[model samples]
Target: MTGATVRPVAIKLDDAMKARLKRLAEARQRTPHWLMREAITDYVEREEKREAFRQDALKAWEAYRSSGLHLSAAEADAWLEQLEQGHDIDPPPCHS
Candidate 1:
């Protein structure tokens, strides 16, 4: 009802996987095509989030290596604990 026309996608699956998909769709009371669409949407969204997390970690690692600026684990944990307790706490400053 979004007024978006549905486009058709043709996929080829091995016989075993095809049978499994049919069983899952039947159990869910959905068509195999609907199940496939839902599965792809879920997978893409999950992978995109994972990719963003990986990129952020890489950037953090590079920054640390280049500047030697970081908070010790204990300091970081203390800051996090305070925040979790709803305390308005600033993060500990990074240092070499």
Candidate 2:
């Protein structure tokens, strides 16, 4: 592997949890260290996406409040219903 700096992380796991991790690692044919690394990577990626989405939602809300530009619930529901039914439709327009 290229010289990628790796930091050591330690976690305190009770006996049962440690046993479970070991069993899962063996079942997956991976080392406990590899499993922990993968689990942490997946968790961080998922949480980062969630945080970004939350920030975008907050910004959209603030913009709507300041400019009063938005689609009514009925309009949004219609667009969403069409999309759910697999119809190709343009998004509803936002207006004051």
Candidate 3:
């Protein structure tokens, strides 16, 4: 490959696990190294996805804190019931 870097590293695994990996690799016509690389890549991608979701949750929390929307549990329920009954209820005026 052009300008691609490759490195060799040793890993330790149990005999049975290594045997299974070898069998699966042969069945898929791939080398153990290739399968291990693919597995690591998949793991990295999954972790990145989890991190992104966490970041999104944090952003949502920040927006919620800044949106000036506040309601107690009873007030929220009352508001929901009002909407269910087709009654027009206005939100409290924003102090700021």
The TM-scores of all predictions, comma-separated, are 0.83, 0.86, 0.63
Candidate 2: count the clashes.
Answer: 0
In model 3, how large is the Cα lDDT of residue 86? Answer: 95
Candidate 2, residues 22-93: lDDT per residue as tens digits?
Answer: 999999999999999899889999999999999999999999999999998899999999999999999977
Tens-digit lDDT string for candidate 3 (22-74): 99999999999889989988999999999999999988678668995556667
How far residue 35's Cα lies from its native spot in candidate 3, in Å, is 0.7
lDDT of 1: 0.95
Per-prediction backbone clash count? 0, 0, 0
Cα RMSD for predicted model 2: 1.8
The parts of candidate 3 lying over 4 Å away from their true place are 1-4, 69-96
C-alpha lDDT (0 to 100) for residue 54 of candidate 2 = 100
Could you tell which candidate, 1 or 3, scores higher by TM-score? 1
Model 2 TM-score is 0.86
Q: lDDT-based ranking, best first? A: 1, 2, 3
The TM-score measured for candidate 3 stands at 0.63
